[model samples]
Target: MSGLEGCWSAPGQVRGKDATSVLRGEWHLGRRYFVLHLRSVAPAQAYEAAITYRAGEKPGGIGSFWMDTFGGLYEPSLGLGAVSPDGFYLDYHFPDAAYHNRFERRGKGWRWTIVERAPGKPDKLFARYELAPASCRGTTFTF
Candidate 1:
C-alpha cells in the first residue's frame, strides 16, 4: 500500500456535481492497516471519510471499513475487494444499494471511480476522480 502513502488532490465530479478532493494515506496500527483520509475541498457541504483497509480472509484480498460524514445511515460501510496489478477494486453491498469502486494507477497518478446500483434503477455513476501527487501542507484534515 506504499503506493498510496502520500497526499493526493483532484478536481472531479461527485454525485454529478463539481468537487475537489484531497486525500491523505498512511499506515497505522503497527502497519497492519492502511488508512485513507479524504476531504472534499469544494462545495459548501463537504464530504469527508476515513477508510481502513487490511488483508482480507483470502490471499491478496482486501477488507475495508468505511466511516464518513453520512455516518453509514444510508449506505453500506463495509467493503470486500481484491488487489489488482495496478490498484484494487471494492464492492459494497447493502439491502437497498450496491457500489463498485475502483482505484487504479494512471500514468504517474491514480484514478478512482465509483458506480452505484440500486434496486429497480439503472446503474449510475457516483464519482470519478483523477488524482495526482500533492503537497500535504494546508490539507484541511489531520491524520
Candidate 2:
C-alpha cells in the first residue's frame, strides 16, 4: 500500500460542478488500516471524508469503512473491493443508491471516479478527480 501513502491534490468535478480536493493517505492501527482523508476546497460546500481500508477475507481483496459529511451518524457505509491492474474498485451500497468508485493511475497522476446507481434511474457520474502528487505542507485538513 506504499503507493497510496502520500499527499495528493485534485481538480475536477463533483456532481458536475467544478471542485478541488486535497487528500492524504496514512497507515494507522500499526499499519492494519490505511486511512484516507479528503477535503473539498471549492464549491463552498465544505465536503470532507475519511475512508479506512483494510485487508479483506480473500487475498488481495479490500474492505472499506467510509465516513463522510453526507453520511448519517448512525449509518454504516461499507464497501468491498479488489485490487486492480492500476489501482482498485469499491462498491458501496446505501439505502437509496449504490456507488461504484474507482481509483486508478493515469500517466503520472491518478484518477478517482464515483458513479452512482439508483432504482429507476441510469448510472450517473457523481464525482471524478484527477489527482497528482502534492506537498503536505500547510494543509488544514489532517487525520
Candidate 3:
C-alpha cells in the first residue's frame, strides 16, 4: 500500500486468436480497487471491469479475476511468501494455471514477471514485463 499505489493505464494487445486491444487501469492501495478496461480495436466494442480485493490476515487475499469480455472468473491472490531484495511477491491464478508474480521497479517503469507453477510440479513458467513510466514504476522496499 506504499509504493505502487495509483491509477495506471497502458496500450497493450492480448496474445490470442481473438486478439483484443486493452487499456489496463489499476487503482492501488487506497480502497483496494483494481480494474482492467478493454476495447476491441477491430470495432467499437468496449467493456469496463472492476475488481475488488478483499482484505484478510492471510499471506494472500483469496479472490477471483473476472474479465469484461466473457465474465471468466480467475483466482487471484496477494500473498507474502515472496521475499527478495528486488520486490514483493504475489500469485495470480486462473482456471487452467497458477502464476507466481514478482512486482519489481526499474528506472521510470516497473518490470512485472510471472512464473507458472502447478500444484505438484516445480514453478518454471516465466513471463516478463517492462512497464512504461505512465504505469506503476518504482522500487520495492523489503523488511
Candidate 4:
C-alpha cells in the first residue's frame, strides 16, 4: 500500500464523454491502514466515494470497506473487499444494483474497473478508471 500513498488522476471518457477522476490515498491510524478518497470532476456532475484499507485481518489478510454516494442518493450499498497479491476486489449488493470492482496497480498506474450486473441480465461495463500520477501537479491532481 505504501507504493500507492499519493494522489493519482484518471482523465478519460465515460459513455463516450470526457470525464475526470482523482484518487487520493493516505495512511491512517499511525500507518496501520489507509483511507482513499475518490472524487470525480465533470461538467455539472459530481461523484465521491471512500475506501478504507486495514492491513492483516489475519496473518496475511488485507480487508477493505467501501461506501459511495449511491447511498446518499437514496440507496445504501455498503460493500466489502478482499485483496490478493495482484490487486483488490470489491462487491456490493443493493436493492436495485449489483456492482463488482477490481483495482490493480500495474507498473506505474492503477487499473480500476467496475462492472454492473442486473437481475436477469448480463454483466455490463460500468466504467474503467485508469489512474496515474498526474505530472502537472507533481504526481497529484489539483481540485
Q: Give the number of the best model, judged by lDDT.
A: 2
Q: Candidate 4 residues 1-143, lDDT tens each? A: 77667888887665556678888888988998787777776737677777777765455455666666755653345456677687877777766777887789878888888788889988888788888975335333332
Residue by residue across 18-123, what tens digits does model 1's lDDT show?
Answer: 8888999999989999998999886686788888899999999999987888875744388999999999989888777888989999987899999999989999
* Residue 113 in candidate 3, Cα distance off native in Å: 0.7
- Model 1: lDDT equals 0.87
By lDDT, the better pick of 2 and 3 is 2
* TM-score-superior candidate, 2 or 4: 2
- Estimate every model's Cα lDDT from 0 to 1: 0.87, 0.88, 0.46, 0.72
Clashing residue pairs in candidate 4 (N, C-alpha, C atoms within 3 angstroms): 71-75
Candidate 3, pairs of clashing residues: 59-79, 60-78
Residue-level lDDT for 74 in candidate 1: 49
Candidate 3 off by > 4 Å:
5-70, 73-85, 94-96, 119-122, 135-143
lDDT by residue (tens digit), candidate 3, 25-121: 5465665654433333455545444433333445443333433444544423333343346655656666556777666776655565668877777
Q: Is candidate 3 or candidate 4 better by TM-score?
A: 4
Candidate 2 segments exceeding 4 Å error = none
How many residue pairs collide in each prediction?
A: 0, 0, 2, 1
Alpha-carbon lDDT of model 3? 0.46
Clashing pairs in 1: none
